[model samples]
Target chain A: MTLSPIQILVIIAAVALGTMITRFLPFFLFPDNKKRPTFVIYLGKVLPYAVIGLLVVYCLREISFSSPAGWLPEGIAILCIAILHFWRENVLLSIGVGTAVYMLLVQYVF
Target chain B: MQSDNLHSPKKPADKRIKTKALKAAFPHTIPVLTGFAFLGIAYGLLMNSKGYGVGWTLLMSLFVFAGSAQYVAITFLTSVFNPLHALLMTLIINARHLFYGIAMLDRFKNTGRLKPYLIFALCDETFSVLCAKEPPAGVEKRWFMFFVALLNHTYWVAGSVTGALLGSTLSFNTKGLDFVLTALFVVIFIDQWKQQKNHAPALIGLLCSTLALVVFGADYFVIPAMIALLAGLALYRKRAEKGETL
Candidate 1:
């Protein structure tokens, strides 16, 4: 709200453009008919592992020691996810159950 | 490669095939439906809290469509107008998609006209679904990917609009709902972990990102962690090629 409507639009436009560039540039670099460089192929193969790892940490990054709740809810919920997933090997079940546990802890217990 | 491709069905993406693909793809996207709904609603409420109306939330969700970046943009929208800074922040935050697009180059190669939108809509959840799951027999690959993207996109937009309209009028507490994303990512990580013989990549990712989060703090750890992970992977790969195991 601090910025005028036009300014907000401009920021949004820039963000959209920047995101497109990130998503599209790699494809342009490794177009069909040409062999993708070995390193890019290596990245393609392994990056998913690393990317998901980063995202998992990204979720827990907000919890601070100064707060009393700290990492308890996140830790417990992660345990719930691992258990549910191992027990049933179901994505929805694990996420639903883990989030429910975390929600209940935050909303009621913590 | 050409002979193998020529043997596969070269369906022209007729409506019937596309519809069939949609049917097959919807079930796979159901998990993403739950994840995106809560996350998108959080984003919409964040925008509303900043005094931006439902119109702006819808416009940004429709246009920007970058989940993490949109959340970050809430901060940007309230800050001073510096287009250059906003652009840089967006690029850094979304640089992860470079990996997704690279990984998808081959899958998306012959998708033809649908390629651009597929790339545009190549979000993290969509990437996981398309990259990790294959369509049923006889469903066109392109159409399957299309529906996954379209369905996820629609769910996101719908969730944001609902949240915007509901603006501060919630009858119930919605705190901790964003954990859906965390759980989803953890689930995907476990799937990848179970499937791979090499756990180095996953371990390195977990270690480096956590290290970055601790060292750099949450507000600015992503890009550094990414850079560190890339360097770490390169070193790890070289060691692996040198007859080193584990």
Candidate 2:
């Protein structure tokens, strides 16, 4: 490592501080004492669904579209998950089967 | 005298509730258990390869508690020292957390002493689990959320520590196992879609993120995606407000 121990600790502290700032800032901005603006409340209602979508995309962000094979495993697995989830509406079942399918694809099929 | 008597009975009952909440929360965290363990182990192994020991791995996983940021931190540790740059990178990577906090503002309200920890521990998986899984009837919501966060945190810390100590001893082709997290999010997205009357938000999120990804590439897409997401939602809110008023 190029960094000395103290420098490493300083970087870690800085990272930790930055992380806490992102996580904690919203609560501080819209404290319970003050009236949260309507836009903020609207965001509170809608952002969760949107954020989950964002997360799903974030997970697949590494997949390359230039090659068909690059995206195949994730594409197939997500298809299976959506199908199984809608068919059965079982959370664990869908996630378990989907992940197992993806593991099999990437490990063997792909 | 009356208040003291009331508090006395509630204390034991509170303990019972906490235990029950922990039990209820465990099943919901099973996916995260698999995901965090694999990812954390990968993280720990990376740290070990970089010559950092168990202490550094454990400390980063426990204190920073953000997976992507920690991975970025490893790069920082190996590169020329620049604390300001590290902090900026961390902030950019974790900026999505701001949205999680906004969404959780109400659900986490009235959590009392547990509020700070709940907010502190609101990592991506914890946030998703808490957002999707409401406490079962008669289970205290605050306690359930707390246990969910605590269990995920434990899995991550333990996994990293195990990896740090084990250091590539086990032999398993664990490739693609980390898809559990992706699967978890997709399932939750579906659940939210079904539960909510409006689909615009979910659609907006997917559209904006995908657009940004195409435009910005993976490394830089997140912030642009976040900005586009906020703009899309704001426009959505405006239209919905008009529809409601009319």
Residue A71 error, candidate 2, Å: 2.7
Q: Lowest summed lDDT over 10 consecutive residues: which window, candidate 2 chain B?
A: B1-10
- How do the residues B148-191 of candidate 1 rate in per-residue lDDT, one tens digit apiece? 99999998899888888787676456688778778889998998
Model 1 CA lDDT for position B82:
91
In CAPRI terms, model 1 is classed as medium
RMSD of 1: 3.8
Runs in model 2 with CA error above 4 Å?
A87-110, B1-10, B171-180, B244-246
- lDDT for predicted candidate 1 compared with the true structure: 0.86
Compare the candidates by DockQ and give the number of the best one. 1
Q: TM-score for candidate 2, please give it.
A: 0.86
> In model 1, what is chain B's TM-score?
0.86
| TM-score, chain B, each candidate | 0.86, 0.86
Candidate 1 chain B least-lDDT 10 residues: B1-10
Task: Write one digit per residue (lDDT tens) for candidate 1, span A12-105.
Answer: 8999999999999988888898988888888888887788898888878898877669888998999999988988998778988998899999
